[model samples]
Target: MSLLGPILLAATLAVPAAFLAACFVPRWRDEALAWQWLAPVPALLAAAAALVAGPFDLSAPALKLSLRLDLPAALLLAVSALLWIAVGAGVLRAPAAPLDRRVAVSWLLTLIGSLGVFVADDLLSFYLVYALVSIPAWGLFAFDPAPETQRAGRVYMAMALLGEAFLLAAFVLLAAGEPHGSLRIPDVVAALPVSPWRDAALALIVAGFGAKMGLVPLNGWMPLAYAATPIPAAAVLSGAGVKAGVIGLVRFLPLGIPLVGWGEALAALGFVTAFYGVLVGVTQPNPKAVLGYSSVSQMGVIAAALGMALAAGDAGAPALVAFYAANHVLVKGALFLAVGAFSARGVRPGLWSLLALALALSLAGLPLTGGFLAKAASKPLFGYGFAALLAAASSAGSALLMLHFSARLPEAWRYEATASPGPLVRFWPAAALGALVLPWLLFPFVGAVGDALSLAKLWDGLWPILLGGLLAYALASAADRLPRIPVGDTIVVGEAAFARMLRVGALFDRLDAAFSRWPAAALALLAIALALAWAAAP
Candidate 1:
């Protein structure tokens, strides 16, 4: 493909996005929702070309916008485009109700950010795209208008704003450290190893991106958000939106150089989160909440792989992580859609349910699935060590969680016996099949597909899944004995914190009210001016 091709692809995202903004006009607002599905087409084209033609870059003078498409990014961009297009269509086709324009606008903005992040070539563009992806999706929760939805939105916004704050600080520190003052990602990352603020920069990057990935204490927003969001919104948010953080880790973290202490620290954290998500997930009754925790767990495993790669100075790790994330993008999106499908009645039980179960198990690395290929491909990074064992255990945990998800399918479907299977069932099989097959085709270009498919590799993928299945069966048989816990375990604790915040806000409000009196305001202004003048004297 020519440079113009990639440029065109990048431009495609903004045009539809721009139209979405224009929707604020009364005349256009309603029509924009119907048109929103087209926004991802350019991204889909760019990703397809990038995969076929190899990587490409484009630049312009006026705005200095740059785009580079490589294997990892292409893999993510392709699948993300697929999910956004499919889900956007599903949303539009669903029974028309009173649609919130604000929700539609937020969706478009999130789509732009989600697509743009995958192709962004420079640090500034990446940051801008990342912000777009994170900040606006709050509207999904906003439109539901329930107390729980409001609370979820509040937590989601808090974490997003916090992440952005950290990213800004990290970006500034990175730019300051660059010897040539270049703001490109490659330039800043090249400078990262020797920079004076390398540790600080890394800290800020991890904290910022970690929040988005839902690592541990930062994870409270995810379950709440996913549980409250509409199905279509949850589909893309879990599948495509969180990939912003994955891409961030790929682009920002210096993988070519060994940073042993930091790498090990990150690895440990990832391991903790992987196990933590499962423990909490199993306790929840809501299937959506379970899937949200599954994402948290799965992303943690990816983080652990990246951490290991960084420690060993493995440049190939990013491609491996991307392949893993790509499988997740499809499988998770399909599973979320499955939630809708399973809720449909009059669907024949045997084939559709079996297919749904198979797709759900794919996340556990069931044999021959894309998840299996992804797991096998990533094995080289874990090598033969404790990390490899941890990886296997995490896969087992995934299997357990997914089995639980499958078992709950019947309960979800029982409510609507007369309802047709809808587009969710019609589109889900394609997405699931795509997730299972596409990685194999891409594996040769990015990694050793033959190695990934080896008999021993197959066994490596198989045993953990078997173990997880057995464990899940045992848990199911003994279900009543398992401890009951609330959805989003620690979120209850967060509610207490929020209550404290209300008290603090009340105090601040009273303070503001007192200061607002004319005499107090004038006195405060005089005090501030006097303090400034005194400080200037030095």
Candidate 2:
């Protein structure tokens, strides 16, 4: 079979989607939920095929749905597929509570988008896939309507819609610039350097993808969303859904061209976000919220890496960034799952929990783990410069935040029995094992395995971990002295801003009321028509 055969990719998406369609029959909804776990299998297969067979393209005759997968896309798709599978399995076994069909539907829709985004070969398909990934996931936030969840959902939706607006504008600008009317990403990007609206197009692209990537200022939604989600849902959203942005950046950004000013600006924004996430993360009490902040920080590091690569006009950066992001997909997903596991199956206070804790801390680039491999792979881009120092320091902050997470675990799990193993038996081990091993295996394909394991690399990975450990230990000793802060600090500030907007909304409501009066409406229409007539007269 051709490695990029549309059959496999189509099946991956279509089968589960067909099942979701079946859910319209009340009799099939439960059965469909049971089988939703199978939706990502085809995606997994397509990813494997793409990785093995190189890039391939397929197009439909009627709808013109172009499907293609390259090495970078396949790598991300594979990891994302794995996350969906693992999380789906966990969800199947989770305590039988009232299941939310809306959440399930959202999951399927997001899955389709997540899978499609990886293979979409043209601009219109990419936009459709991006929309699928962004819009439906809001249902995951809205399944239950707690204040935090509602607020988080609102923020997430707002950012997502804003991102969509920017990306659509960028896509429109890109299409307009294409002399041949080509909507293929490669074609558009090839023309971008010489395009008249290059600057505006790039700005829109950055803003659009940056919002999804949770870049600073636009990043407020992440902590709020992750903090409110169910553990399994959080795992997939954090691990897989967010990668839509990563892949978008990889595919959309013109890497061959050097745009020094723009690249440096992005890098600066990234560095600030990296440190900003940690600074806020340390203050938060919820482990999940801390992890969310950590994602913001880690993605910042990625943005910095991409910026450096762009500045240098390095083509090798995408694979390296993918490797880094792929590792994060596994580790962060596992960590979020671990939170649930540890909570359900009480850790025996000492070694067991400590080992789990240690593994969790590995997200901070702890030595001899997937996180280190990710960090090591990116080292070349940073190259012993200020960027390198900043990246390493971010690792230190990751360690500290993870330590706070570990400390919080005991309290969260205190009510459960330590002796009786719960769901963690099935869930945690798979997640942890995936986090530790998958990156190593994938490293050789994208990077040199020898570079990943060298003594110099080992030390580079080790010291930051050690520093974080020492800091964690010191904080533990002075635990009481630490002031308790709310999870998602700036989120509180954001909420206040939202409240202020509500007051503004009331004023706007009054304005609309006045504007809708018959005399006022007629007068506005007349004024607009006269203005148009005057402009046209010239």
Candidate 3:
């Protein structure tokens, strides 16, 4: 490997690590917070290098660690680094102080982990960075004094830990399955198809990464987290933080070989989650919550595409999914910023509103936008089957949900005319514009630009969005009639179930205490001896 590649790759991590380390010094902490946005520069450069110069790998055998940047990883890393830089600059600017030390610490740590996961090539390293991406982020939202924010943070952390457990177990199985006991991700995944625990590993992998991506039953944290977090934090977490799971799935899944049953099951789950988000999202009053559901819906589409690819053993699915997800990373991030921007003023019929509408519909694959290309790129994976039809249908659903989100933004608008809306809010339009147009630059890696702009392709993208717009219009008149599901729909029920389980555990504790008595213990011992003796006689 060229020295430049290694230096860039190593610095991608080291620079962030250095900033985070400096946060420990009292004097440097403020400066660290002010300059934290710059930490992603190296990562952005590394991503550019990989994309232009091709994939590269770096290893430290003595330390048993490795890093690699493939097309999928590079695509995600570049956009994600952009998100971190843009959002971080707005949130952590010099005047934004006095930023809380904890929030700063959390942001830096989360930034490092978010960028780290894309390059991590080994199972152990991936798991560690994945945890970093998932865990410290609780502070981003939960540091607020609001009761709901605190609750959201707790729920987010619980889900993160649970997901970690699933991933760790799956990784252990993957490592064990490799006859050579290789820790490198590619080696382990190559062996996964024939592993004795293949089914079990795939199941765990789905459950673990699915939790991060906000798949159903586990998706409850997203609405609450996004709704509760500050807009800048929401932008990055929704944009960059969650892609850890996408990279996880892209890296770990044995996508080169078709596992028909598992792939079909995953795709089915994805479609279910997709429509489910739309059905629930339109009823939501909070724009942030609606966007959170939009993410849930969007992630479902990615999962479905991947599942389809997995089912067909299509090796090209990773890059296509990355392209799709890259669009999402920008769009969703900018939409959250838009919420903040729109909220800064009273609702009016003007350019801002028009821009908001454009952004919202873009998620539904409006032509000429990045989303349209993302959807176009994903078509081959589904290949005109029922899954393809469902994919198109999901775009319509996305349109309906996003339209609902745009309509609801006015509810968050401030009546105050005298106050400044702050830098992050001010930066929203540029972010939104970038989100819409930037995918054109990325589409070429996955597909030809000329093909994406063809008349048939344009119509293909338009129809679903039009269908969704019709649904939105129909629903708008009857909006009040739509059922209002709670922000984290299933989470409340899960909490109640957990409470009941705790009560049952208390009862078992009392029973155990009762059984611990000397006489009871002696009787149990005698019974065990008698049983053993009887078995021996047999």
Candidate 4:
């Protein structure tokens, strides 16, 4: 490719890498934190450049690394870069004391990996960046001494490590199955359909990435982790970092070929997660926790769409999925920032509350909003019949969950301190506005603007939201009667099981101790010798 493309792509990672490197120096550490917001600028520029310049690849044979930016990656990268910039600025530029060095370093590391995943073209590089997005992010919130936060962090780390193992095994299978020994992602994926171990590899790939996307059975960490983190960190992690799994699915799945069984199975799982989030979220009192559940639900919608696309062998599904995810990247991050802003002590909760409400409802595909367009863009994948109905039902579920989120906000505002809000708090509205409008600007890249605004399309998006609103109102009186599911619903069960396992291990330790004692050891040896003598005589 041309030099401009490579340079811009290289600078996306290089700028963040340089800043992260500078953080090691005691003198430059403060400076690094001060200007950390500027790090994503290159990525933003690269994303914009990719629009006109088209896809480009940067390869380093010596380093065994390759990076490519295509339409799907660029869509996500651009929005994610914007989120990182806005939230990073607010966090780092706050009027408070300087941030802890570790948080700063972890932030940069996570930022690099978050952006890096979109461009990484090789299996090895994608795995490394995905790890970067998933692992060091523990420092973002786990530093708090709160017991719940610590527990959440531990669970988060365990899930991340588990996901890594799944992905690594899958990658190995993909590599082994490739006859040419090509390590490039496209090469491996193209070969996957014909690979001897195709089914096993696809299963692992779905499970590995599914964990990150908060898909069912593996989704326990997401809500807990998000609720535990500070708002700014939550915004980025929820928005940008989580999408690494999305990109993984988009890149690795052979969408060009139909896999009816796998697609349907994945779609079924996605729908389950989508509704499950709503069922549990309305009962939640914590606004942050509610939003966390909303993410689970929304991600499920995306997964479902992708799964349908895979079933039909729709090669164009990647761009549509990316567009849907791109809208989510902004809206979710903005919601977190809005939470921080609304929770500020001295701020009057009136006007900001309405703004926050609009942002929240947008997730439900509110008419003419970015979410509406996102829903519209993905409509082709769902088509008519049961899948289409589920998509509408998901919108309603999102609406119900988001409305619940808004209802929980007043309580959050009431308990806050009386201190004046920071610049970051004030910056929230701008971020919210960006989340609403930016998708409209980018919608043309994926589909026609006129189609999203059609009378029929508007009605399609609206009824579900209205139904959800009615449900929220009807349930408001009985919300307290709903059982309180913990932030990570299934995680409590897992933890209890682990505790029991530990007790079992303790019993084994005692048995081992008894067996190791002189009398028991001598008896065992004597018994073995007698048995050997008997056998020899025979």
**Each candidate's TM vs. the true structure?**
0.89, 0.88, 0.92, 0.93
Q: How far is candidate 3 from the true structure (C-alpha RMSD, Å)?
A: 4.9
Deviation in angstroms for 487 in model 4? 1.2
User: Per-residue lDDT of 1-538 in model 4, one digit per residue for the tens?
Assistant: 3888899889999999999998888787778888888999989988888876689889999999999999999999999999999888867753224446778889999999999999999999999999999999999888888888899999999999999999999999999989999999999999999999999999999999999999998888998988778888889999999999899999999999999988888889899999998998887887888888898898888889889988988899999999999999999998987777777742466887787888899999999789899999988999898999999999998999998988887766553322223766888888888999999988988999987788999999999999999999899888668998878988887888989999999999999898777686798899999999999994
Q: Report the C-alpha lDDT of model 3 over 21-78, residue by residue, as the tens digit.
A: 9888878877887888899999999999888889998999997889999899999999
Candidates in order: C-alpha RMSD to true structure: 6.9, 6.7, 4.9, 4.1
Ten contiguous residues minimizing lDDT sum, candidate 4: 412-421
- State which candidate has the highest TM-score: 4
Tens-place lDDT digits, model 1, residues 442-522: 677667767777899889888998999888988888888788766656667878888999999999999989877759678
349 Cα displacement, candidate 3 (Å): 4.1
Give the lDDT of residue 180 in candidate 2. 96
- What is the C-alpha local distance difference test score of each model? 0.83, 0.81, 0.88, 0.89
Poorly placed runs, candidate 4 (over 4 Å): 94-99, 413-421, 504-538
Residue-level error in angstroms, candidate 3, position 330: 0.4
Off by over 4 Å in 2: 1-4, 93-99, 413-425, 474-491, 501-538
The pairs that clash in candidate 3 are none
